[model samples]
Target chain A: MPEKAQILDQLYELIQPFAKEPIEFGEQTDLIDEVGLDSMKIMDMVMQIEDHFDVSIPLNVLTDVRTIGDMAGQLQGLMKDD
Target chain B: MSELLNKFLPLEAKRSELVAIGGADPFHVVVERVVSATEAIVNGQQVIMAGTNNYLGLTFDPESVEASCAAVRDEGTGTTGSRMANGSYGAHLALERALADFYACPAAIVFSTGYIANLGILSTLTGSGDVILMDADCHASIYDGTRLGAAQVVRFRHNDAANLERRLQRLEDKAKRTLVVVEGIYSMLGDRAPLQEIVEVKNRYGASLLIDEAHSLGVLGDHGRGLAEELGVEDQVDFITGTFSKSLGSIGGYCVSRWAELEFMRYAMRPYIFTASSSPSLIASTRIALKKLNSGTVLRKQLWANAHQLYQGLAEMGLELGPQVSPVIAIRLPVSMEEAPGVWGELLSKGIYVNLVLPPATPDGGCLLRCSLSAAHSPEQIDRILAAFSDIKEKIAPEKSG
Candidate 1:
């Protein structure tokens, strides 16, 4: 499984196309309110993460994710489970 | 009977408030005359038909009309019984063969209506033990299909292939038995499914895939088979369902597949066996429409042109739009839920008619002025529709413009 730093790097690259501006990936920064990830944008990122990690992240898992850090941590956990 | 009536008591009480705001049930708008594919007379006003599911605008096609007339003369007006009980005419079998050939699939089953296609297929294919992971924004017919089948239904985020995969992952060992259902073009949003990505996810999970091509058939792809063909994943799709109502300009629904297992559904599916077969006229007209769609290069081009023009026109007006440029263009209402009817009423009063979608029916609890463009709509009609939107927006919610 990849580390949190690796997951965060991939997350930044994944969101670039949908992000209106550069995203400041702070640990506590809300993905929706701070990173400006709307419903569509979040879905796009989820698809990229699924492909990149070869892991199927559940829809309910998203409810637990608030920030980019949470997403990266989630990805790390899912990858380890795989 | 009284207990049955009790269920709708609250909704019945809600009707007066709608009538108070010039909104009469929006569901039952009477059309007095259909002047053209794009023009209809409704309640004494000649309104532009920006709400029809007539994507290819071939409702008045001479060839289609002639075919329908010919079938009626040869085979009589209607089949008086179900397909299993003498309703199955020789033409019905022929239509199924023709549809299978059109999609290059091994088999196809035609249902009485587009809605019934899902009702029969989904209900029959999966059962109580199986799980169905559908897009959250799937058509009501699909939701009904799963319920009828007695399957555990789980909804993924709309158009999110990842969300779909995630839901399947939760199934674990049962993932192989799961069915992933999506639509080619969502009716409300007008956006397409990411077929390639979905196929990948399906393959990764060893799950099955079904796509409802209700809105995209004859509107997308070089072959006009639907979004599956457009994305070059036609072979990857396990089941492809579509309607004759939209682009075919007729009535009926079909599910085509490479697997011959679809033939088994004929005997097993209640919706297929018990339902009265499509009339000879509908089958003949649809056959011709399918053939026309196969060679409808110019027609598809015209449809895309019309869709692009309408989408760009609304976008230029600074109106909120769906994700993509499709035959369906939805303009958001920037007002309260109660104020939506006033805006819809004003649009209708101005000789422009669109599908007025309210919260609960609309996704994200939004209201929309759904404009479904047809190939038959003239360029002038599109311009007029745009002006109506601009005028209505400026009048209803002028503060948004500032």
Candidate 2:
């Protein structure tokens, strides 16, 4: 798997376009509200991330993910299978 | 606890907010009276309609209207039973034959609605151990059909042939078992699939291809066949599905194919068998509309002309538009979601009735004020629509060029 920091950065970049204001990604940062990502935007971002990382992140995986930290952890689990 | 109700609370809240912002109920903006193919009275105000997908504008055609009325009076209103039982009227078979002749395919099957055509065909054509290679942005019916078929569904990027090839390459026995599906013109974006490119990829991989010409029919090709015919890949496409609702100005769906084996779908397709067949009036009127769609060169030219006119007019207002220009001209909102419906409501109050598409339906998360143009729309009506936009230009639409 790629480095955690690197994955986090990619995740940040994925959502940066949808952000309402200048935002930063940290462990506890809410991916939805803080990043201003709607459910559809998140779905689009997840697909892009899956394409980039060569991993299949299912909808159920995202159901449990709320914060940037949760996303990183989920990505780690999915990429380990690869 | 009622688990279903609990599960739907979030959706309930979202819909409530959407309805609240639109002032009136957004879902049912009832057309109080339809004055013509392009004009309707909504909430007691006469409005120029840009929402109805009457692309060829045959709904109010005197011939179609007369024939349909006659059928309704003579034959009856409905089949009242599923086609599998006693519902296969003579008119249904006739429409199917006409569709097959129009597509120049060996066989065609007509369904009650376009939704059922996808549901029936996609399910019956595949099963367990087969795989469906679908576009990520495919219509919901396509996805549901795959689910019902119990096939492994893998989504490629929308309209990206390379992405499709990549998925097909990864599959074992890559070609023989995989079914790749795309839309001739995607309903949401009004963008077309690179059917020639998709066909090339499918052929190279030996995979079968299905193109849903739901939006492109009567709007794209020289003969109004669809995007596949427009791109000169009609013969190569394994299956072509389309709706009679939009261009035909009637309610029904059809799938045509060169393969004679497709006729066996009458026995195997559940959605087709279990559902009531289309009424005689719909079939009769649809037959009339199909002839016009096939032979009306002037109508096709006028549709494109109107499309380009509205597309350019919206672009001049600095509004974001769907890629290229077709009958469906989708204007996206660059503002917040809250403001999206407000703009839609405002447009309605100004004697304009267009679609207010929100999240999940739109390709991106953005909202859209989608307009479906028709050939019958007069130049004066087009001007009125443009002027309505001019009336509320800066307040709602973003100042983003192109």
Candidate 3:
């Protein structure tokens, strides 16, 4: 399994295209409040991350995920289970 | 302002801005009088209805009206209690049996409204540690049901069987504990679930499948049993839930299942046990309406004919529509959101009333002028509706219409 840092890098890459406006990409950047990704765009980005990591991230885990770093941790945990 | 009321400031501001646009308020349309199943006096003007989901238009069926009247006279008006208390009247049990027989299922339960049916069933069926795999485009009631329950909720891409398979595959042994939920015909777009493929995936993963046929009942299949019957997969679908408000022309909801365990849900569902049961008049009319819908071949034919006519007319006008021809046809506005209220207001002024759908409520955050056809609507009514849309086509798609 890839490290959480590597997963965070991949998630940032996957989420960049969904940003409606250009902004600094970082681990602590709030996806909804700062990056301005709407709910629909967030779902799309989640699908892309799911495909990239070949992991199924249950929505139950998404309630606590707000930043890119939180998503990376979730994805890394899902990958370790495999 | 109180903390409870402060949160509504943003929504209230949006409504105020929409009202300032100098058009009819889409949220506060007042129907002064009902002219018929197809026409209503809205805002003091008689309009052709294209938004009401009265697919079979049985609301004014002479026999049903008489039956409801007789029920009101004989059984009085309301049940006055929940089914768990003193409310399971003979009529309620009879309706449940009739619904079970109509769907050819062994067990059935009834709720006060369609929304309650989803809430009661979904919350009672699964518990903590269980997962609900639902289509992302499912109705609000389905979403609310998942939230009300303790189960883990996961949404698959809408109508994508491969995505569903991937989620189920990841669940592995937990797949058996998962409940997959989808709708027969999506309310907004009027698109249907790929039930055959979805059923296959569910069976492969040992998951149960529940189909909400709220929009498809009396609109699909030879016998109008909905998408499962239309796709010849009724046996594969474990639970079928639908509303009486739409096709039945009454107000109630039902869920029919072959599982003997569903009888337990009647006792366990808090939504059912706490809420008052459907009134006797509604139940009586629904009984007759279900019988009519069961054999509503002629009405279904006319309904489809009207759907085709309106769809073809809108498409010819260069206005966008849902993916296919359905009784529920939504015209996606190719213009800005600010322009939609005016367009909808203009349609209403032309004696045409359709639903004006905005973002978040819409699947894609786009504006929509949604129309649902009724069997009661005549060919001329369809023509008038088309003409009304044609009169304002340029506002919807100026470049395309030009």
Candidate 4:
């Protein structure tokens, strides 16, 4: 698995375009509540992440994911399997 | 307000904003009277119906009407029980058999509606530890069905065969347990799935496949068997699900499979077992409609001709449309959501009725004026629909600079 810090850095770059306004974010920032990515945007971002990491992320994993840290953790686990 | 209802406040606000700017509320359109298959009275004006999805235009066929009336008289109204209990009327069995014969599949199961058919079949077929690899642009029913089951669902890019193959490769041995799902024609953009390519990928991975032909039935194929038949890939597809509400001009849905194991799903599917079966009249009318559709070569030809006419007309006017010519044509409106309802209202005022689709529901978050042609639309009606569109060209199309 890639380092958690590395995953967070990549996620920040990927999610910036979906945010309504530019604002600083970190691992604990809520992807939905703080960053304001709607469900559709979130799905689009997930597809990008899947392609970037060459991992197939099951949608079931995302339901439990809320924070940026949660997403990084999920991505780490998915990448480890690869 | 209850805490449970608080989640809907944002949606309510958005709707209120839409309603405020509307000449006609897209969500609250009421058909006061059904004048014909191609016309309806909406908001006290007679408008050409272009979004009903009644492809074959058998909604008012004399034979279907007579059959429905006769069935109502002979069998009364609703089936008071589920198909699992006492509701398996002779007509229900006949409809199922007719469907099986139509598809040349070994077994078929009917549900109360198309949504339930997807829910039942998808949820029941796969369980814990299994994975469902579905197209990202699949319908809400397909997504819900995946969520209802214990299957770990992964989505490939819409209509992208290579993406599907890569995912299958990633799954490795787990690919055997994956059920790949796709729709014949995606509902929003009216684009067809690359069925032949998808089938080849599924075959390579040994993954099972299910296709929802909800929009493509009676709109494609040499005999209207949908994309599978159109592309000569029927035998390769494992399951075919479709709706009677579209081409068949009735209500209900069915899933036909080449595998006899589908017969097992009849009892195992909760959506099928717990829900009451379709009314006898519905089954009777659907039976008649299916027969009409089966031999509807002339109707299919007319439907395609109309589709090409509208598609070409819209294209010539510089209006962006869905990927290809289809009976279901969606004109992407180069306008904001605030202005879209007004454009649809303009059409309604000009005696034309088409669906106004907005963000999230639309493929690219663009506004769409969706038109679905029917065999019943006459040349004059098509001309009128075209003319109405031309009148609003400035409002819908982006301004071109020379």
Candidate 5:
């Protein structure tokens, strides 16, 4: 798997518990709609992401994230910044 | 801008209407009104108050009133600071000591509100990498606290120990750090948690336990110590968190544990460190209330009697009730949002007040008229409430029958 695909798979694994249905890892998968992530569940996912990647994602970033690709891109950006 | 605000508006507008109707205060003492509490006084009407949470009826007690007055006179209006700053005073320490003795625990930390107690304790104790196994029906405060802690929170079925066991079994070997949370008595459904089974599950999983005794503190146990003591697992549980707002007739919360290190969390918990400490008057009144709780077996008996009377009354009316009888008697209404408003309005017209709960607040897509009984309620008052319900049934019965 490519590096981005590997990262996306890890993110999907972290979000699986909170998702009401199976989540597909790709650029177009809407994080909130497909996974049924409410505000609380979204925060839970963010915390897990922070711990797993060892990076702090500000809560404000959640408002801009709509899809798995958005989240992965944000994570990648945070990793680069670190 | 207005349109943008509309987009964020609640979709359940009809349910809000029903709540508003139920809460409208009648201008007359005899009429049932939700918001106009003083209206009942003006009308000279015999209103049966079922909406209030004054379970022990201590709020009406002369002794409590006097104690509150004295505390206000002695301690002034507020503490005006956080416990981490200027919040802790002599009265706060005294109350903490009293709660420690009452629970027979080595350490007790008080919070400004019952909500904060859960928030402070849960958020501070658990963190990233820790797990929180909670009941699905746990209070919103507990859920928010777990969120604030940023822990991996998993919920089991409401009051189901076996499901909790199954969830715990799936946790990593590092599950020893997991925190299991449960409530002593659920607020919405008026049902008690299976503490014994939950404790057994926790022990088997090697997880720590935190039980929020907000509803059960003065309503359960021999000395009103709460579910932990009532179930004979007081020593087994790691922490007991409760509030003075419910049965104690005051405003504050506390968590007690045998672990001395629990006290250090007080310093780190943001809710405790940021919020202003509870007022001196509240602490004084709560301390007195605790003493009254310890000595007043008669009050508890009377409360139970009233609860049973109301439960049986509602049950005989063929109203759907909770699983087990408690001080809270929730009458499940037919699941029609349109019909609920009419019934709630009729109840208020009959001079009886009750809490109107609609989805998604109620479980299983039902509406609830939650009636809370108090120890101070006279047998006559309970009968009066039943009579109002009967009258309501008569008015609504024809609609259903037709």
Candidate 6:
């Protein structure tokens, strides 16, 4: 798998525990809407992402993080910054 | 499908039966007044407030008010930043120390709100593999905190020690870091938890226990230390979390524990480290309120007297109350969602203000008009409240009788 695809898969796995339905790690899957992530659960997912990636995703990053693709992109950006 | 979302939505097909006047402020109505609030002129009516959580009646107490004013003068309007930056004041440390002494614990940490205190403590303390075995009726805060921790969350029947033990036994032997959570007094039903039985279960399982005393902080125990103290298991319980909003008549929460690791959680806990610390005036006022709460056994006696009076008065009216009565007395109503609004409207129209809880919030398809009595309430106020309930009974009885 490509690095971006790997990152997306990891995000999907982190959210899969809390998600009501099976999550697809592709485009068109909106993390908040399609996956049914409530505000509190989304926060928990964010904390998990931080620990998994070993990167502190700033609170501002959440504003743009609506889907798995967006999250992967943000993670990619953070990895580059490292 | 977003059916789950649709199910939880307050503004769905359920709207036709109940009118949604405004946005989500939980109370579902806007207030249009400011006054001296032993009794408030709410929405153009002089309403006797049996709903307010002003337990000790210290919100308008001369000493409390004066202490708050003095603190505001000494410290500015707001801390203006998180405790990590500019929020931690001398008052905050002093209040933490005072709480530690009050609970007779080694250390205590304060949070911005009661909800966040649970969120911070539970989320920070437990991790991915840990399990949190909680009472099914534990407050939303406790549930949210467990969710945040990503822990294996299992809930037992409310106040049932045997059920709690069964769930603990079901967990894997390696999951030894299990945390058990229970409330001192349930907010909706107004019933106390069986703390002694719960503590016994926790001890048997070798699990850590956290008791939230939000409702019972000043109402239970001789010194008002709370349920565990009342049950004589205070030392056995690992952690005690409570709020100043109820009896202390302020707006903050605290977690007290004998464990030294609790102190380190202040640095690591996101809710504690990220959010702005409590205001200096709130800290100072809470400190003062704690002193009064510890010293004033007379106030507690008056509170119970008022509670008993209201409880008996409501029962005499043939209204269905909960199994037990504490400071909070919930009048059980018919199960229909439609009946709740009418009862709530009638009570409000009769110049008595009480909380209206609907289906899912109340247990087993129950609806309740939850009335919380304060020590500040005079006998006359209590009499008037009973009169309003009596009038409500008269209005609703004929229709049911037919």
Candidate that scores best on TM-score: 4
Q: Which segments of candidate 5 are over 4 A away from where they belong?
A: A1-82, B1-46, B394-402
Q: Which residue runs of candidate 4 sit more than 4 Å off their true CA positions?
A: B1-3
Error of 1 at B284 (Å): 1.6
lDDT pick, better of 2 and 4: 4
Model 4 chain B lowest lDDT segment of ten: B15-24
Q: Could you tell me the TM-score of candidate 3?
A: 0.96
Expressed as tens digits, the lDDT of each residue in B106-218 for candidate 3 is: 99998999999999988878899898999989999998888888998888889999999999998999999999999999999999999999999999999999999999999
- B133-232, model 2: which lDDT tens digit per residue? 8888899899778767866667788888887787676674835788899998888778889888899988988889999999989988888999988988
Tell me the interface RMSD of every candidate, in Å.
5.8, 3.6, 1.7, 0.8, 9.9, 13.8
Write candidate 3's Cα lDDT for A1-82 as tens digits: 8987788777777888888788888889999998898777787788788878877777778888999988888887887888
**Relative to the true structure, how large is the alpha-carbon lDDT of every model?**
0.84, 0.84, 0.90, 0.92, 0.78, 0.80
TM-score of each: 0.82, 0.87, 0.96, 0.98, 0.79, 0.78
The digit string of per-residue lDDT tens for model 4 on B1-402 reads: 799999999987888888788756888889999999999999888899999999999999999999999999999899898978875899999999999999999899989999999999889899998999999999999999988888899999999999999999999999999999999999888899999999999999999999999999988898899999999999999999999999999999999999988998786888999999999888998999999889859999999999989999989999989998898899998889988888998999999999998988887778999999999999888999999999999888877879
Relative to the real complex, the DockQ score for model 2 comes to 0.19
How do the residues A62-81 of candidate 2 rate in per-residue lDDT, one tens digit apiece? Answer: 76899988998989976775
- Write down the lDDT that model 1 would get: 0.84
Q: Which residue pairs overlap in candidate 3's backbone? A: none
Instruction: Report the C-alpha lDDT of model 6 over B134-229, residue by residue, as the tens digit.
Output: 777788898788767766666666788876776676554723688888999898888989988888878877899899999999988889898887
Report lDDT (Cα) of residue A1, candidate 5: 20
Q: 3 or 6: which has the higher TM-score? A: 3
Q: Model 4 in CAPRI terms: which quality?
A: high
Of candidates 5 and 4, the better by TM-score: 4
- Candidate 6's TM-score on the B chain: 0.92
